[model samples]
Target chain A: MLILQKISQNKTLAATINQIHYVVIIGEGLVGGALRDYLINTFNYKFFYNVKTPWTDKTLIEAHFNELKTFIFEKIFNSQKTELAAPSFLQLSFVWSAGKAGFAASFTDIDEEEKDFHSFLNLLTQIDQERPAFVKMDLHFTSSAGGLFEGQSSVQEDSQPHPLRPYGILKLRQEQKITEWSQNKSYFHGVIYRLSTVYGRIRRGQRMGLISIMLQNGLHKKITPITGDLYTLRDYVHSMDIARMITSGMISSHKPHKSPSNNLQVLFGLSQKPTSIFEIKAIIEFHLKHKIYIQFNHTPGNARDITFGKIQPPFEVQARDIRSGIKDVLTDWYGAHT
Target chain B: MEGTLSVSTITPVYCGAQYLEELIKQLERVRQEWQSKNYPIQIVESIFVVDAAKDDSLAILKTISNNKAYPWIKVIELSKNFGQHPATMCGVLYSTGDWLITLDEDLQHHPREFIELFKAFAASSYDVVYAKPKDSVHQSLFRDWGSRGYKKLIAKITKNPFVIDFNSFRLIRGSIARAAASVCGHETYFDVAICWFTNKITTQKLSLEDQRYINTGTSSYNLFSLLSHARRLIVSSQTKILRLGAWIGIASILLSVALGLHFLYLKIYDPEAIPVRGWTSLYLTLLFMGGLTSTLLSIIIEYLSSISLQNQGKPLFFMVDRSSDALIQKFLNHEPIDH
Candidate 1:
């Protein structure tokens, strides 16, 4: 109670008000952990995530609702603290993570829609419950690419979700949903980043980032049995740069100012420069200083080469080159937990 | 085209016991036609989803259960009747095939069209082949008008100029069908969902003869029910009201001014039309305005329902573990390995 009062009155605290937002990432994957770090130390926001689960456990159904309720009442409402007073700077700028997005989609595997959809709902359950007043960002990543290459660029903010696969389609539908969820809610503002392909994190799981997989295998001097094709390039950006850009967005809420019709800002977060698989392989090979075997089935068409430079919102940091990024990730990989 | 694609024929039977005989007759004929001609597609399975049928549908299925004559037939009896769409969704939930097709059990939509749907699907890159009713013999003028009007109205509202021939009789790529089926909600326009899930949709024209035996079969829908379905479709499939509201809002402004001027002209230029009874005009004005206000309120509620559905953390569909083998394996791989 005393801490809340003292913090509210503290000008120094208010000055860095852009640093006070918080979030709970339920999926403890690379993106989830990165979002947590950005919100805590980098952005310095406070948050509470109720649970983390592997997949479709019956427990998540309850955990989702429970944490969402707590966020709505105890955390979000309590965070506001004053009436009509402009939130301190830290509370603004941006609050987002380009977490669950798929690059390519196909007609097979409709069940993925069910699984990916739950994550969206879990997040929404949190969004609806917390209805945060101070924070202005409800940034999410939906499958924007599926609807793009499926004949035309029908992936507008209002276009129907033409998901080739269940994952991309569900994610695309989630874009419409979050837009609808944030509308007239009066609590928090929203912005969505249509991230291309994020690299740099050295996550070790079955669903590890593709770049990490290749780099990891190269570091270990093994052959990476790559899926899809070699020419399949994506707008891969380093995680730290992505985080820095997100922090910058949370700090400055200008450019595409908030609106009722468009509180949901959509940005295709490429590195302002794209990286292809061949380049990525070369970079990894150079960085590791080893002869990494090259294996190409074919270059997949999942990588989108569309334009996204119009709403190029400013960021504070630069994304690393795939070559340099491979070295950094390798160093971090061995540095942590090794 | 090898045309060897197997078909999963699904029929969502509500209180449609009367239509069962004709529906089965059509299916039997279709089975014979495809088998005899060696049609490119083979009958993978036949699913009769009888939801809450008070009639002897369970008894009917029992009569056929032991009969080895029908190569592949699956009867799923729901504990209770879950309504038309839900019942249909239940069948979709149970179906397993490369191509999923549905038709009205009332026999209004013939089984002869199945071959056409299959042929088109096999010969093209289209993910979903949308069937349009080329002719309707059994529909009354009122029903036809209602159907056409609803189509146009929903199209205007959704802003997706859909072909008018949309019905239960259609063939969808198995993947698209499952994708649309996965997000199955209690209430959804299944056809619109198909469009939302696919890029290539081919439209085929067909003719329907009159369905005479609809009397004994119970119709759970009235005009009010029709309106409700239309309401649900308009709400879920499209976000037309904000634009509609803008148009109506402008119209209201224009109408209010025009009415105001007319009233002024009447009061100033000619006092005779007023009837010298102040209560009449006052009551008339109040009545008109009251009705208009109610219409506006209902529109607002419909918009709010869409917003709530969209915003609320609701899944498009839920999967039951009754019969999904592939899904089980996929789910396993996604989970953490014990090692």
Candidate 2:
């Protein structure tokens, strides 16, 4: 057995594992940043969040990954041992499961979607290979539920994923590869969380997240158009709720003697309620105390509506109502603007 | 006002996010000014083709496009960092206007000077009008001289008359610009494609400043980028230098043939006139071999040049609109010659 011990500190591997939980979150975009903030503020976990900086060359990405690996190793080696029981290593990554829509717009062109999947798989492989020694690491991977299991009215953790779009197909492939890889590793506790339409206050001018787009347009007094009419339904979940559920799930259970067959687990991080675009717009208007100008177009490229099953987590997690979430987002956005 | 020609301005952005806000503001001001004047030419859209900039230029472009003040702003985020010319061509392909203007995202090409270019076009029948700086260009002396020398060399080598006056800040007719852009391959020099389409190209003198360089004290283009541009320019034009090689080959062959005939005449008619009998034969043999080698090499070069020109879409014959010369001469007489 490879024992990872702190050379400078008087601590055994098992004792150190019991003391502090080190979490490394990769791709510090909207979702990753929110999770980091929630974990730090609520649970006070030590985190090594890797934020992508603007790079001009390909070598910079490799350099950054090396730096992150060194940092993770050093953190694991220097942590003090305690008597409290907790998992030692935790890794989370937020990836663009849908990729750039323009590249995957045409269903016939699977090249870009394939490229996104390969890169995603490569990152997972790197994580699996570069994890700290002598520690059972709990790896929580987040993917888009809506983007993966497309054309389904209701989706569950065990739903037969039949994706119609190239983006969805690529995401499903990534999930399968992760599952296969996790089942082969005994010490790796991999949980795949398929999140629904996540919304919150994002950076201004960001084109992602429907809620952010509507709010930015409203603030700028521009008419926002809803493609494929207002009846497009989606399970809208707040980023805060997502962060809470993920953190709770990470801290909830530890089964040490689990077999390779049961090493990988799947969860749906979704709100059971499904809201239409019309309802969302109405909620935003109520929160902002003004009517947002909206127009609907009969476009064919809108994402197929999806419903979520009950979010059965090992621990109890409460999700904010859609209206309250919108209110919170608006308050934050308004505060930032003012 | 209804029948006025609409214009679309295209700027290929690469690491110019710092000045993007000011650029958009100036563009908006120009649009408003044109609207107030009831100008016959109106800027219908300002298309920004962001070539995966190293900075947050895409974000800035998105912000500008989202602004309510500039309804005509369009941002095209390219998947990769294609060079400026290819990015400009991408924008031109997406544009819908009567005329298309291509400029840099940096304030080097001032938005206010669109009026001057418009006036120049109005005065002439030229389809393309380039805005050339009359005073010193806002770049290092080395860069300015290097660019001038490269352009002159390219013009002389390709026998292309319009390349010497080629500038990024140009106002081109919409249909011609789009058609030219559509035919451009990955290796096509965009300016050469414009020249291939029309010879009715002229220049307007302007006093422009590179504000970005002034602020940052650094240029976006370095030695490597200039060399890449030079390579593209040479590849996209016909190799008149190769043709010169072919001419030299033909002249050598002719000279050798004339000398051989004279030697044969001397051997047949005046046998005693050759003082050194073996020397004459040796000299003739050397001349024949040298001529043969040069002729063969030149032919190979000529063949290679033809292949390159074919790939570059060089047509055997193209129609020219000579009637535009009268309007061009009139415009020239009215315009002041730049020193």
Candidate 3:
């Protein structure tokens, strides 16, 4: 009987200890960071990697999984982890667990066309060698689902994921790769969730999106250029919604089946209703109470990602409408920044 | 109308005893269905290549062959214990047919899918028919990702756009099978090399019957076995130097040097505009790079497995312990294995 262990990049592994284990996650990008926060806040889990105080609020944000920092680097990165002395301090905060890993390795700006998707798969392979775990979900991009399965059109029962960008196309190929891998039965469960643009309050100078960039422009009264038609639809869900869906599905006794297969389920993350970029701008403008000049130039952005028909989960939240979500963002922003 | 086929196939008696019986039963159903469909499945031959099984599986296989009466059947027991792939090759080497289907002893690949593969092969102009899994036979995300990574890497090596199949099931023409086996000499992976060897490939997507893992019972490929498999396809493939060099140059040293030169020039010319006036950020940067370099170095080092294999001139597999060269002769004396 050979005992196996998965030494995850998260410094902390996502799975409960298994007798034989393997875990695979890649990039440790924005969504991945939020996943770590979900694990820390929801489970009150501690690890040996980083220097940061534990998170208490049920808020979600993203960060990379640091293998070297363990529980040691959390404090180093989170100088405020000890200074913020109360539970009421939950306006908006995050403790990044930095490590000897490449948190500061810089590279020249890459051409948008120069990215290699195959290398991304290879990097995933490298990560798996450190800790081998069956990936439950492949959080990436996609395109059409070829045709209907069991009856419903893909966009109706499944995520009708037709991604328009090269990045998303790479992600689509990845999803295909994951599905095929799951088929090979290398001890892997295949789950993929195509997420909407994740949004929430953030400490400026991070990300290039409507929420962060718009918030910055609104604060500075800088004119923000609108990409594409102002009404381009985006299924922007709360970062918490992203966190909630993943944790619940993974830990839940009954793993949600996209179909009865229990092998592959690809889903889309959205509110009960779809929201457009223009609608988001209106909400932010109304709540922030500051109307920065809107330079409307309709050149288009993000290959116009295809939409999906809403599949309501039984545990759906009445869910903050666009207006409410904007308020939540503004309130969290003011409280955190101030 | 037999839309599906059931046939009892066996991986034979050897160490695969753990997996043989279940494989036979799965194929038995497929074989039965093929007959019921009135399908023109050239003469069906039940094949068993008994390499020293070291367990009851071989005996069980013997018991099975003794008890059963069906189409033309033959068991080729080697003189000693040869591994599964070599034994399989030995079985295929002598197969008398225009097409040959090979599968693992593990129950991950259901033999019932032969009809689907056969039908797809019939419908297409392509010589190779690949049965793609709609999902996985195992439940781990890491292994799935790693397997995918391996496929991509091998694809890169061969410069052949690989149409990955559910490696557990595939059907190829007799000529292609022999050709692939010849080119793969002593390499652990036969499936991937086949992909490298072929240009025309088609895929048929199918789903696993839910209890895939429990059905396989336990995998014979332990952690070491899995890694070795990865090494064989990626690191030990016929072309590693050019691929490895291109990869390292593109990924690591070149980028590192460019960054280093840029930072050095920045520090030497304009000390006033140094991004880091203090040493804290510098220390953090150093720690980060130190770790990154070490990790990448280790990755590059792992690609050296082919060197060891070539140096010893050690063959990858050896045929062993066979009791029935005469039985194989006798079976052939009657008719071909495929007959």
Q: Against the true structure, whose TM-score is highest?
A: 2
Q: Which ten residues in a row have the lowest lDDT in candidate 2 chain A?
A: A1-10
Q: Please write out the lDDT profile of model 2 over residues A55-160, one tens digit for every residue.
A: 3343454566555555555555334223223234432323232343431356644555455445545654665676544344565667777777654653555677
Docking category of candidate 1: incorrect
Query: What TM-score does the first chain of candidate 3 have?
Result: 0.60
How do the candidates rank by TM-score, highest first? 2, 1, 3
What is the lDDT of every predicted structure here?
A: 0.55, 0.67, 0.47
Better of 1 and 3 by TM-score: 1
| Model 1 per-residue lDDT tens digits across residues A1-338 | 00011123456654544334444344444554565565567444444434444344544655555555554456445555554354543232223232333444343443444454555556555655555434444443423442343322212333333445455665566677777766656555555565546666677664567789887787777788765544333456666666665555544443334443435556545554334454465456546655466565543344322222112433435565555666778888879857
Cα deviation at B114, candidate 3, in Å, is 0.9
DockQ of 1: 0.01
Per-model DockQ against the true two-chain complex: 0.01, 0.01, 0.00
Best by lDDT: 2
lDDT of 2 by residue, B46-150 (tens): 888889899999988887677766657877778899999999988876665557899998889999898788667766577899998887675667657777889
**How well is each residue in A1-338 modelled by candidate 3, as lDDT tens digits?**
00012233353443432211211222233444555555567555343233232122112111222332222124322433354432121111111111111211223211221133333334334433433122222223222222111112113543344543334444455567767654644333334555555566554554534665676688778887765444344455665565565544443312343342335556655553434454455456555655546676645343132233334541343334555666776776778778
Q: What share of the true interface contacts does candidate 2 keep?
A: 0.00
Off by over 4 Å in 2: A1-338, B214-217, B268-279, B289-304, B314-339
What local lDDT score does residue A152 receive in model 3, on the 0 to 100 scale? Answer: 21
> lDDT rank, highest first?
2, 1, 3
